[model samples]
Target chain A: MSTGNWLDARAGGARLSRRGVLVGGGLLVGGGLLLAGCGGRERPSIESRDVGSDRDRNKRRLREILDRQTEAVKNKDEKAYLADLDSSNSDLVEHERMVFANLRQFEFAEFGYNTRRVAAHGDYTFGPVFRITQLTADESPVGAAPAETFRYRLAPKDGRLVIAEITPASPGDQKDALLSGPPADEAWNMTPLRVVQAADNVWLVGDDSVPDLEKFAAAAAAEAAIVRRLWEGRARFPGDVMYLTRDDDNYRRWFSLGKSSNFLPEISGFQTSRTGVRQNGQVYSDQRAGAAILINLKNIRDYYSGEDPRVTMHHELAHSVTAQLRATPSIISDLGSPTWAVEGFATWATGVRWPSEASRYRSQLRNGLGSFKGLPSSKDFYGAKRSLNYLLGWSVFAYIAQIKGREAAVEFYAQVIPLNDTLEPFVELPIFDGICERTLGTSAGAFLEGWQRFVRRGAGA
Target chain B: MLMVAAIVGLLGALVAGVGAYLPTNRYQATATTVPCRRVVCIPVLKASAVIDALKAKGHPCEQERDHHWKCELMVGTLTFETTIEEVEGLISDVSVLVVRPPDEEPTEAVMDYLLWLAALPYTADEALTEEINDWVVDRIEADEDAEAEIGGYNYYVVTSNPGSIRLRVIGALR
Candidate 1:
């Protein structure tokens, strides 16, 4: 649906954001009392002396380390950035150094850490920390991306708290009440990484296998240029971070989410949105803290040998650029957009780059026209007939772009895509009709007829 | 090399002969209906007998509109509403709407009902039958839909909510 077998990577970081807000509010209230006391007002001691005190102390100490690290990043001081990590563990220190190097490649507009829930573990203290990073407008068009929460482990070394290990944060790490669970097992955090930077376009990250990493980075750079040209003014072109894994277990670990099956070759490459919290009663918020592109190297090995990688990279990059526009923070599962529009837009963009694909889609449409069931439903998109549905969907966008105009097609997509869960028994047909009439100056039926004719003409049927 | 090749051929024949008696097919198919248990093929139940079986199993069966009956049966922790269509005093088709949770286990009783509906041969052990049902459920859960023609019957399945699996069984594949 996305690029190859396009599946959107699930981001459960909203739970982390809500926790950050609560903790931030408490800190503000606590700070108010201390500030009042500083003004020479007669008040009882507001200093905590219980478990809250210990938590408060830890929070303050962690904040100081985070502050120094943030400032170091601003100054491009790699030494200062690595100084806060636990030096006793050389692996941890080395990893942080690599992390610093990786992070330094990006031109961030906003970057900081929000200290969330903290707890004691054996002799060390660990908790979930939300690392908020937003690339500059020149880089990422979407200003505020989704915040990635990581488990920052701290231990008392040399009579002070130093960073022990920073692990991939999971929904379980946000647990303070009835909701909280455990940490995640992410491939990126689990293995030693090989980071390759491709100008301002991509950071190709793989594991252990670095010989052909530069080649992939170069290809990614070329694809990124092609995506920028295709999307140009319509979408964001933030320097995307791409993960390429050789290990089947790592690929499965990264892409499988929680499914039992590990091998999914249908998934060529995918873009995961780190979805942010919806604020001000809004149904959709383009504000995501970050997004990343993951290429299933194990499954997509055949695609690499073929020319499918060019098509897949372009398609996934299209997703990465338009990631925030499709963000539906209110819904845990992104349901606002129809699978057809989402997949169709990306597929259409791919066709724009390769003219041969246009003829291919035309041929598919001509063959499938007899059994065409209006637009492909959500069922059709993920069903056994997914490939046909994908081509059929691509035809919709191709028609709109050709007949109504490309700008109109983009507008129609933007308006129709967002928040309504098509998976449920939600009536989306009327909504589609309304949007179609308003955007394309035709009823849904008329648009379908026009699309059918356009397909027939293109196919010379 | 000739002697080694001869020995390999002999071993392959031995393995194939052993495999013939392994019962790998599981469900045995006869001309029209698969035999029940070990022998003596069970006839396909009439609509009245099927209704009686459902009632005896403690499932709530009620007559809906003309010749249609709806039954409430618990499969795992999820309740399934099974709607039966009868044409001329015979069960024509059956459809089930099961809204299950993501982690819900496949139930043997439900699989048994499906087997009965299809008139397919049942596996010897109930647990083994449930295991086969689990495999089917896993396939449906992963792919969202699965279709298979087995023992003169067509099995069609579609799932939603990554949990609620709805099953529809037509009379036969042909």
Candidate 2:
């Protein structure tokens, strides 16, 4: 791909419109207010500092809002958190519900929150950005510790200090800020659609038109349920509001709408296009708010007889959950995991039966194996033979997870992400043997032979 | 002298005319006169048998039992037939030849050329039909040859000979 094409591939080019501004603005206010009451004594002083004309006092007020937001998230006070939001923006209210819903997954002890003051602009202030460095327990034990920074915009609302907007910064943005440089344009664009409470801990946002809000809400609720099941007893990033749009242009626009907003360190956005085939009935894209799993509506209707969209939703959510745990440094950083492992774990969580599709895919592989021996070029990633890699890799990963356990497999993935190497060694025999021997107390050569045999048998059958 | 010449010419004409009517020495014994009705029946049965034979060789053919079925069997220009009394015995000598026309004007010796072509194992539709026409001519010649081979048979009687025989055979064959 050319540089322009690469940029095009990454760029959805959707600007944060007035509605997005309102929604993003509402969450910072809502989440900020809930945190405002965290230190009961600090609340009065924080309010008074807002009245002070001194820049230091104003900065302190901003810092206090960050502190309270962290505290409010830790306390899980949905009503108190929502009370600070601008009621005029129902979208923001919806976004707050989403943030709260995701935050409810982790225990307070699992959260490691810190805030740093970056810069201040007139009435609209940026930062004292909060970072979630570690979640204590994860279903997938990523080898690396991932961190995110949340940029909070504080301005006076109703004669008192309140958060105007909250934006999540990418790792690249954080690196640029550390270097005292302007964040990269691409990095600055990460923003989640504002959160809103739908039902109980379930949150909804205006991902689609108001008429489809109920449908979107139901999808959000079902998605939350799947996440709850997959990441049960594990600390995770919050589930995001489900965005839906039939218009391809609108879907692309909705995905890129976070560019103009302040960054949130912890929360991530999940954006997907209404167009394109959902590979394996599921596809996902991750941003700062959370991961969005875009189920191709037509495929769902055509292929899945059971009419369960939740499976695909959960599969994509699994990717989001894994991403949150790994939190790769660069957007292009390989998680040092095989596509199969990533897809398999997600598939397993989503209750995909591999054996059913195994025969069809095995036949495809056997017929195409000669052409597939060469390493796939980037273009080949979407080709028919790619399914061989997905299926085979998934089987291998599933086997590793089954034999050595899911925790070890996840740890292996985490270790690989920082290596910055090609995936050939991981897929090869000797290295796999070594990894398996060390991690699973098994011989790698034996495992390879066994897997080959298993695959051959599957093909034969 | 003119009268003598005229008388001699008249005598020569009389001998030529008499010779034309006389039986030729070549097919004196083998030629037999069968009824025209039998010839017609033979062609239909032989055509049906040939179609069945072609089908048996894996050449798919449509079998029609209606009035127009026999007419359809003559798909190409040439056709030939042979028959036996019992119908079952018809399989021994019965042969139906289907001839396909050549692209250009065929030469006079084309019939003989087609007989030689029929001896080959495989035949395309056009070649096969042409060969059938040639085979019909060969069978007629064979009848003449058979008469010549059996100059006189003690048990069987010969009804026709070569010169007059050719006309009678051709008429009956058609």
Candidate 3:
């Protein structure tokens, strides 16, 4: 198996084991050193008290506090959880507020809770404990699993326990914990946030974290809405999945195209993954019935902070969606689309009308046209004059779609692959001429001249 | 009573003797040389903003020098000769050295040698001369190739390589 498949298998196995631990409440303390008599010990008599009974009372108090706090979280009672906080400690109060706010951001049908530790000093008590809560979808299939374990920390406040710190641990941390004896399937470090059910067959999973999960979800949903609108009547690929990771390592390892050299443009996302293939003018299927797209959360944040990340998402999604609508039965199809058309179409679909800084694009195109004779190479597509390809392809596709209608445009987009397979130009002058003659009753050369003239006028060259 | 009078006289003399032995400026003005890294030596000569303003522009001052000090840099030759007054205006804690080639040369050759040595790496002694010679050869060859179209010339133009420049700067300080 390839490296990517191996990693996926490991990640899947880990996710399953994490799920088991959340349900089982298996204690993993120290390094795989399970406490022997944990489940076997019986409760001591309530009336048994002496001079050393303060320690016992404190332990009892910690257990009581934990039980109440866990119940409050399981019931999704934001007010009850906050009510347990000590008003004297502002830090504890703030932490509780943040944790509850994080939990409330997600929609879930059920939750699970576990408390690990509780310590007391005189009148004051601090419980540094783990609370694992499961998130179940409302319309889950029979025996369909609930995505579980959104972890939280509960600390003592106002003589009571309050939820504090709700950030998920990293996968590396989970791996360390597992090596030291925590169950294998703990999702503490794995799961990304947004998972979408696209039609009946396709599932778009965005596993990324943001300082603002709500905003991320909204942005993701907006991008998905655009895809649904654009490919309304097209064929859908089955079990086509997209995975987004908010972690930096995930983005650098998976998505960094220049560094990794995996250059599989069709299976593009913010994070890196293996390539995708189409077969004989159709989309191909694997055992999982889908493909995975991983996006680094940190990179997304960086790009979004500087520029609109919506376009980046749309660009990757366009490749995945387009490939899905054009897969075959048996023979594997290489990514036959030209760099110009593939990137150009996505650029257009994402509404990035121009490449780079607008002023720079205009001046560079004007200079390049004045000195050069033909189109720039694929390598130079996104360089200084990267926008030229997008401008040309969009104009051509728009022109065809306008006169020939949307169906014809879709058909033309699909045909470019087969045309490419024969080592032919995407639209040879003769073929373009024939399409124009059939669709709009125009000659190919006249149309080409018109396009040149229009572009020159647009650029004021 | 005689014993008491003698004790008082002795105490008075002791106090006067202690007052007479106070620290003097002659010792305070004396400067000591400390061994420093070659990289640190050049920037010291460049003089900080506070020192540069005190000494008028274009006036080279030898604020400090270490002839006997041990140093790691021992390449190109560096020399300086200046009065304490001139350097004191530009810097504090000053010393000076009069630099000369290993052997005497014609006046024109001396001027060229001084300029070339200033641009090269320097340390206290002749320890790094071999390394400096190798660097000089490589530099001359590179210069010739770069300026080949400019026609042949006896005088070589020096282009700064970053590594060599850093080393030279460090060596000057030492």
Candidate 3 Cα misplacement greater than 4 A, ranges: A1-211, A238-242, A255-308, A325-335, A352-387, A398-411, A418-424, A429-446, A459-461, B1-174
The CA-based lDDT of model 1 is what? 0.55
Interface RMSD of candidate 2, in Å, is: 57.4
| TM-score (C-alpha, index-matched) for candidate 2 | 0.39
- TM-score for all models, in order of appearance: 0.55, 0.39, 0.34
Tell me the native contact fraction for each prediction: 0.00, 0.00, 0.00
lDDT of 1 by residue, B14-66 (tens): 22332332333222321223233322222343456556655655568989689
Q: Score the docking of each candidate (DockQ).
A: 0.01, 0.00, 0.00
lDDT of 1 at A104: 69
Per residue, candidate 1 scores C-alpha lDDT tens digits across A233-329 of: 7655466777776566666566334342223445777766554321110111445445677776655666556433567778888777776566453
Candidate topping TM-score: 1
Better of 1 and 2 by TM-score: 1
Candidate 3 residue lDDT tens string, A251-286 = 444323334334333332532222211110011122
Residue A263 lDDT, candidate 1, scale 0-100:
30
Model 1 residue A161 lDDT?
Answer: 85
